[model samples]
Target chain A: MFGLEKKDARLLILVAVLVAFAPFILNPFPEGSGLAQFNAGYPDLMQRFVIFGIFAIGFNILFGLTGYLSFGHAAFLGVGSYAAMWMMKLLTMNVIPGIVVSVIVAGVFSLAVGWISLRRSGIYFSILTLAFAQMSYSLAYSVLTPLTGGETGLQPKITDPRILDAALAPGATPKANLFGLEMGSSVELGMGSWLFTFNAGYYVAAIVMLVAFYMSIRIFRSPFGMMLRAVKSNQQRLNYTGLNTKPYTLAAFVISGMYAGLAGGLMVAMDTQVGAERMFWTASGEVVLMTILGGVGTLIGPVLGAGAIKYMENILSKINSDILHTWFAFLPDGLEDFVVTLIYPFIGKGWHLTLGLIFMAVVIFLPGGLVEGGQKIAKLFKRKSPVDDSPDGKTTPAE
Target chain B: MGILEVKNVGKRFGGLQALGDVNLSIAENSVHAIIGPNGAGKSTLLNCLVGKLIPDTGSVMFDGQSVLGRKPYEINQMGISRVFQTPEIFGDLSVMENMMIPCFAKRDGSFKPNVFINMLKDREIVERAEHMLEEMNMSDKRHMHAASMSRGDKRRLEIGMCLSQEPRLLLLDEPTAGMARADTNNTIDLLKQIKEERNITIAIIEHDMHVVFSLAERITVLAQGTPLVEDTPDNIKGHPKVREAYLGETQEAA
Candidate 1:
């Protein structure tokens, strides 16, 4: 409906349905059950999924369409976080103002970075972005310590002036909210053995993510999106075709940066803190990993990739050797130890190693990421039919 | 005054003089061909005109405006469009999408706030692109990936794309350089049709004598980075200096 093709509209509706039902679906196991650990319906984790989804969606606009692999988007995210934290410190605890400030701040910051980095293409452009991001991170760590809160990080304190809202009841701590709706508040509904907990913050974040996704869909189907794809397809031809590609690219970069900022603002709204570590180059690398792992250019690929990585990072990392032992207890003593040892490097603190292996597998086999894998499955089903099914109506479905 | 004026334009790269004190005045609505051997600065001079390579000395003026330091896209916006030797269409896009880019550029100038408008819903752009493709006889291949097309089709699509921009000046760098005879003749006919219908200026850099002589009303022969002769096709074919520069290459070529 929002400038989307029929297929694109269908995709948007599918995503909306999925996001709406996530809390119920993810929290299928009842509370206090052994499988509850896998329940991703928790407000904190659920919030991360949508926030990072926003980040990845924005990144796809730049990298997927324009083919500009920025290595410094985390800097924008960090800038957004810092802006949100300051907004909370200076203004009211209304998450709305904080979110707005973060997007604007990140947009401006990315504009300066993109203006300089877009001067070069290929790896040189990536390195230029990396240099700018690292500079921001280092500056936040030391030189800009007073503003950034240095080694500690920025946090809203009760003593600091909050001019917008009524003076807080003297000794109360500041809490991020939408008007007066507490972000941390949740409603838990239990039916028989299954318990579903939906947090206000996660729903808010999910709604924002839906809007971000809808906007991306509009962009992907727009003439502007065609220009961006054109930029990636043949920039030389585009220049000859009389398009100044710099503006198109710069606009993409800033838009992606604003998305990063939105993600950052959401993170602080949920957690109420800003850290210099968020600006680290490794953080930028994480987004790249998510995009590539899920399918670099596809609509739902980044979100799926982000969910997979975040799930592994938060859930699998929590599984210690003791849990492995409990699961393998039925085996003989020697076999149990052997099995635990074998699976040890793929979970718990070694979760990153598992992530790396999975990433490598995705890159080597399904270079289009998990979206390609899904397409392959769809193709197999179509092949079983009598009609020669053009899966997704293209030779390559995911790209 | 001609529509395009090159006055003492020279470009030196290290010790090599790519172009030296080159002077030419191309009239409006004329077909001008620049022919030279390899490394004779034919490409260098063309690059200078399109602002791809800034000449080390002298000036190039198109439509009475200096084009010395303008960017390639900026030069294009000044109503000059170039078709590359290797057919530079967007391989990742469909043929229709490839044609629409130039149409969009022409209608919206160099840049537009076209982000929010649905491409499929842009009836004007879609019709314009479809009409251009129909004229190129590529209407059926409109939805095919541009990169998958035959070389002849690719060249045709590129020319169609350039023409869709409705440029005042069309620069063709060996439009039929690597084509079979059939495809070459097709390209020639296409150019003829375009010429009759558009009333636009064409400056082509070509190596084929037959193709050059058949199409060019006036020819500029370049040798060692300088214009050797500028004359009518009949005179160029018979002139001793032109033959001397050609070194009997045309006879053997024929």
Candidate 2:
């Protein structure tokens, strides 16, 4: 059972199945149809799903269990991407070094920040983290421009010496690879108007995400997780019970930072690009939004939230007036224009408005997030379930 | 030597002296009760003993080590556990989880980052916690949420949690405060049983004379940030000095 409890092991299997078949599930539309634009089975978007999922999962380790809401987590992600980009530039295009370097760099950076920021809890802790992140972003943009490539971003170049990699096939640009397998390599299968892409990059990210999810489950059930939860619940009691809570919390913060770094590294491995804007404060807020919208403390909630937000950003934002006009073409001429105008604000440019409304609804109605919604549904089913032919099939909601 | 010794401990805030020239010695394996009206510095003295407050002058020695400026967790590691006035149990955890935290602290020392180890398989810790729950008669409430329990139950769980750490000295700050008569008597019995069955010292600060007389072997009366008298419980009842200081009676001519 991989050292997991029966319940956790079952959950892992279910997630594995879901993640493995996501390309098929997300691409229900035909390629030539009007709805083809909504397909998320493409390599670029699929890689994003797994990458951001890792980011949110890592954030949950700190914020969910320990109740420390970090507003500067994106700094770690940005630092990670920058590190990965440098690894690819200076070393080989092999992503292992890039990933390893990013995780290590982000861990060290987070340790420094967590050490200082963790001195205070609640609002002060949040402000200190925010300040640290802003400092990192400012440094990356201005002072560290040589290292970070300034506003243009650090990108891989053909002239750089990739010590581990042999001379490339003549006149070819570098791409991230695992051994000899190119990360951008993909296999496209088409049946009639239906098209599905199985990308080597997407699979790598998915496998990494699966491992990260499994590790998160282990942490969630470990005695260490109990201690983290104790830190969240009553740190005073823990301290009095002869436990130093600061170190435990710092470990969580560092772990969360490393997760962000892994996500960042994966992003580069897929797109082979790293931008300073990824480390911006708003980007940090986006991960926070993902974790909260999914469910603050639940294991699968953050991944679900990350996927939801990314999908909305990618798919919903593509709905321009042209798409709206086509949908409303069946209506009368005056009503068709009116409907398109009415729907214009929330799609494309105003997708943030839709996302904001969803975030608010999750916070207000489902404080426990999407996980709580699932639990409520499960509870309802449990209440309605009847006994199986036990002389009398007498089971009502009252029981 | 006393298990806990406080010599001339004084704490001042701006213009007021919260604790002034306070000296106390709690002998090993004895129950000592500190009784005072509000603002008489009983709680202040208790805070000093646990390292929550550092006295401006004087030393607090527990088991021959200076407890001054040590963190509360360090103080607890030296075999002193405190039960708070408001029942400070972890509200987000289950009753069993709450019970096991002190066990982890005691067995693993002050800190260990033992992450990735399955807690469900921790056999020794589980048995110890279950045994403690059985002693507290809370075995049925093991899976219950600690926060959802009644106040009396919370107090019971908190006390049980303190005992599981196996501290040499237990400090109770108004253990029976704000409880109904029935719950108060239950707590009294629990304390009486603990004192008889274990080789542990106890220091209790209380406003209730009933609880003080029931458990205290020696009683110290405080008034205006100083000890007025120290005597046995029986003699402390009608002692004229104690009567005048505690009851606000005018002293008659000697």
Candidate 3:
């Protein structure tokens, strides 16, 4: 339909359906229900799901295709956020300019970083990127204090002159918007005990995520993408075949960096703030984890991984000891206490322990990641369905 | 005047003079072979021709253009393609993809960021790749992974990839190294066919006398970083100096 192969087009439609109906899909539990704490339908968390999905999808283009792992990807995201913040603070509250400028600024920054770092490959390249990200993080935290707002971070303020925007009312606060539609504004739909909240910002981010995903699909099928894969397969052979590997790798790095920047811009548009912590090495590592966990080379794997990680970060971390105790209150007091204590560490702030275990399990049993797991399950079901036909076909074939 | 001219090319590796005062010319549309023992500098000279090594004392020219300072891909774009000792195909890619990459490289030059053009939809590239795969007799294995293919198949694919580019000069470094007898014979036949079918210059560095005698029109015998003799394969075979320096050693080794 969109100049895509049949299978890819179907996958895109399926994802579009999933994203468009995410509020309902993610909020399966009704309000005040015991499982309501696990619901991820709220505007803030929903925005993050799509935003990081964009980030991981971009990361996949580099790490998946070219096998160039940039541990400094989040630096581009941070740069984008800062750029978007400045755009909102000075130019306008509308997000179009902020997002556009963020992508361009991040592309330029990544070009410089990629040019130098791509000279090395394998582990050295990874470490070089890590060093660049750390440097950017440290600089933004300290030396670039005036520009980055240092430890305080940056926020749109009333005192700042917004040249492209109308003057704020006497005491009104600046809110990020899309042509006057406030990002945070949401419409609530209540049906009996279930309440679904659809936020303007979440929809905006989701649409952007869809576009990014489509573009990634296009790239995956492109001649350029084939060359990138060739780079990963055998760079020496590629060079000998009259195709330069340097420019291809550099282009992938910059394109992925721009994707990260788009994600960072979306984050600011949703929340209206920028922080240096976003550029931390851990944030960069998170995107890598997401890409590997979902599926390294598969097109939709990164998005699934991003959604899984972000969903866990929000829902699992929100499960405090109090909630655990309440859920187990039906058991005898001592038994309930024992159960809660045993399960407590894996939930709430200790969610990382659970995530770590899941990551290990995925890597060990499903090296192809969650996508492989899904495919295996699908195969199992298909095999079961053909059981009746298989016996008859076997006997008839023998005859 | 030959397609490739190597004159007084010397490469030193610190205290070791790998290639010293070598002069050779490979004529257009001819198969030339370089035969040497373990450290006879055959590979070094091949490397110098393909831009992998810079000669300290000579000019390596291709079609009147200096190929000394250019990068490997640049040299390749200038109508020269190299096949490695080990069949250097993209193992992870499918056979058809391996064939298509060279076609893309041939069409796009060193680098072209045409990121939006669908590879499968690019009829020109697909047709050319299909044609090459057919020519290589690997049409059925197009969907199979390149790594999973047998060694002979990989070598065939690599040679096919080089040929798809229609390179004016094709350089092979031990093209049939580490192959079974049957596979070695198959490769020889393929090379013979390629020679008869294409107007391409082939420069081969081989350790096997059988392959050289069957394929090379002219032979250059090198002994310790210098060519001892260069002549028609039949003449070179009968030369006393060639027999003592190269053929006699192989005869004894046998």
Best by lDDT: 3
Q: How are the candidates ranked when ordered by lDDT, highest leading?
A: 3, 1, 2
- Model 1, span B1-254: residue lDDT tens: 87899999999999999898899989999999998778889999999999899999999999899999999999999999999999999887888888888999988877775777888788999999999999999998877778889899999999999999888999999999889999898999999889899979999999888788789999998999999999999988888987888737866875
Model 3 steric clash total? 0
In model 2, residue pairs whose N, Cα or C atoms come closer than 3 Å (at least 3 residues apart or on different chains), thus clashing, are none
Backbone clashes in model 1, listed as residue pairs: none
* Residue-level lDDT tens digits of model 3 in A167-230: 9988799999999999999999998899999999999999999999999998988889888888
Query: If scored against the real structure, what TM-score would every candidate get?
Result: 0.96, 0.96, 0.96
Question: Candidate 2's residue-wise lDDT over A1-399, tens digit each?
Answer: 889888778988998998898888889999878888889999899999999999999999999889999999999999999999989988999999999999999999999999999999999999999999998888889999999988999889998888878988888999899998999999988878888899999999999999999999889878788898889889999999999898899999999999999999899999988778898899999999999888877788899999999999999999899999888899999999998888898999799999999889988888878777776788787775322311100010000
DockQ score for candidate 1 = 0.60
Write model 1 residue lDDT over A179-214, tens digit each, in one string. Answer: 899999999887888878889999999999999998
DockQ of 3: 0.49
Measured with C-alpha atoms, the lDDT of residue A57 in candidate 2 is: 97
Winning model by DockQ: 1
True contacts kept of each: 0.74, 0.76, 0.78
Lowest-sum lDDT 10-residue window in model 1 chain A: A386-395
Docking level of model 2? medium
Candidate RMSDs in Å, in order, are 2.2, 4.5, 4.7
What level of docking quality does candidate 3 show? medium
